[model samples]
Target: MKLFLVTKVVPFIMQLFVRFIYISSKKVFHHPKIDSKEPFIVAFWHGELLMQPFNYKRIRPKGKVSAMISEHKDGEAITRTVEYLGIDSIRGSSTRGGAKALIGAIKELKAGYDIAITPDGPKGPRHSVADGIVAISQKTNARILIFNCRPTKYWQFNSWDKFIVPKPFGKLEFFIQEPLDISSLEQKEAKELIQDKMLLNAMK
Candidate 1:
């Protein structure tokens, strides 16, 4: 029963819920000038993951999008959910299957797909940026696009990242910063810049 719910039932329900909330709400965007054809290493905090598929659609409707998801059970539900929403899921994370995931993400970006990564995810030191994403950006020579959102009304979970889901029928603001090219910087310097940008746009 639990397996069935995680693999099938949860994703189905969550998809319906996400669609209703997003369709009913007013969306506002603060986007930079974007080139629809270039791939990006799209970074956002883990807590803000819920609305990103739709957000990505608005920003780059024709661009392909993929996300790195952990191989855990909770991630199973999320994987199915995002796939349902038209984004591909690369199964791995920092603690498990890290190498394979990194390679997969690099390939995706080189193939012209925008790969979304949660700088802090699959468990946390909550909002801290991880080096894996920066390394991927460097290896693929793709710029990191920082994205985040805030909803006028919501529920905040007591998880490590204080995960939030916007209440139905509210306003949602999607924020996007200009892409950061870290290929020329030292790894430490690049990681710090990504962290600073993520922290600056973090939802309240």
Candidate 2:
């Protein structure tokens, strides 16, 4: 029963809720032009995750996108939710199935999919960068693109990442930072670079 609710009921409700909010909100994206043809490792904070599928579709609908989702129970729901929006999921995270996840992500990027990741996820030091994201870039030679979203009015959860839910008819602002090439950098340096860029571009 719990599995049915988590995998089926939750996603069904979430898709309706997300779509309603997105349709009612005023979305504003701030970014320079980017090539749709080039693949990127799209990184965003877990707290800012709810609206990303909509944001990604609005910004780069033509690009094939897939995300590395954790194997946590909640992750299953999220994977189903995003699939409704046409985004693919590669199951795993920093804690569980990390090796296989990284390998899958690298393969996806090489195969021309924009691999999305919430670097501080599956459990968090909330909003902090993890080494695995950098390692994926190092192994795949993929550039990392930071995507951040902030809403004018929202509910903030007491969760570790201070998760947010945008209220209806609110303004949703998105920022897409310049992509960074970390393919040759040391893991520590690359992690810091991505973290700094993410912090600098954070909308709120």
Candidate 3:
């Protein structure tokens, strides 16, 4: 009974929180070369997950976009939020079921679904990229695009990732880095290169 109440009531409250975020985040997308319809992987830090979904919803790609979520309680909450926004979720992480998740992402990409991943997510060393994204990109020949969201006013959590919650009606800056092609590089090299690019772009 307790579990049932928590699941139903907690998500209802979270849905309100998500609505507040959607209304507050004013997104400015910086995609000069890539069109919204193009199939590519969007990599962002987990801290910005709250607002990233709003940005993706605005973009409205013709294909589905899948996000990786860990199989944890918090991840269950996140999966609910993602589903609310009409985006698909794949449950896994670097430590558990990581390989399976990567393969799933690859298949999603091959089926023409644009994928989004919070590289430093589910549990993080804070802004670090795992090899799964790189592997999926290389296997699927998808371009990886680094994205970050900067909010004008927000509260930062004390958590590992310092998760941000934007104040209602605050402006958000969405930065999209140039796409990195993984077609030529080997898996090891591609992973390092993508990680470096994400780190560098996330700074601004």
| Candidate achieving the largest lDDT | 1
Which candidate would rank higher by lDDT, 1 or 2? 1
lDDT of 1 by residue, 102-169 (tens): 99999998888889999799898898877899889889889988988899999999999999999989
Residue 179 accuracy (lDDT) in model 1 = 85
Candidate 3 C-alpha RMSD relative to the actual structure: 2.3
lDDT of 2 by residue, 1-204 (tens): 999998899899999999999999998988757778788898999999899887788779677898999987778999999998889999999999899999999899888889999999978998789888988888777888888888999999998888989999999998888778987788788888888899875645
What are the runs in model 2 whose C-alpha is more than 4 Å off? Answer: none
lDDT of each: 0.89, 0.87, 0.76
Q: How far in Å is the alpha carbon of 102 misplaced in model 1?
A: 0.7
The positional error of residue 28 in candidate 3, measured at the CA in angstroms, is 2.8
User: Clash pairs of candidate 3?
Assistant: none
Better of 1 and 3 by TM-score: 1
Among residues 3 or more apart in sequence or in different chains, the pairs in candidate 2 whose N, CA or C atoms overlap within 3 Å are none
Model 1's alpha-carbon lDDT is: 0.89
lDDT of 3: 0.76
Better of 2 and 3 by lDDT: 2
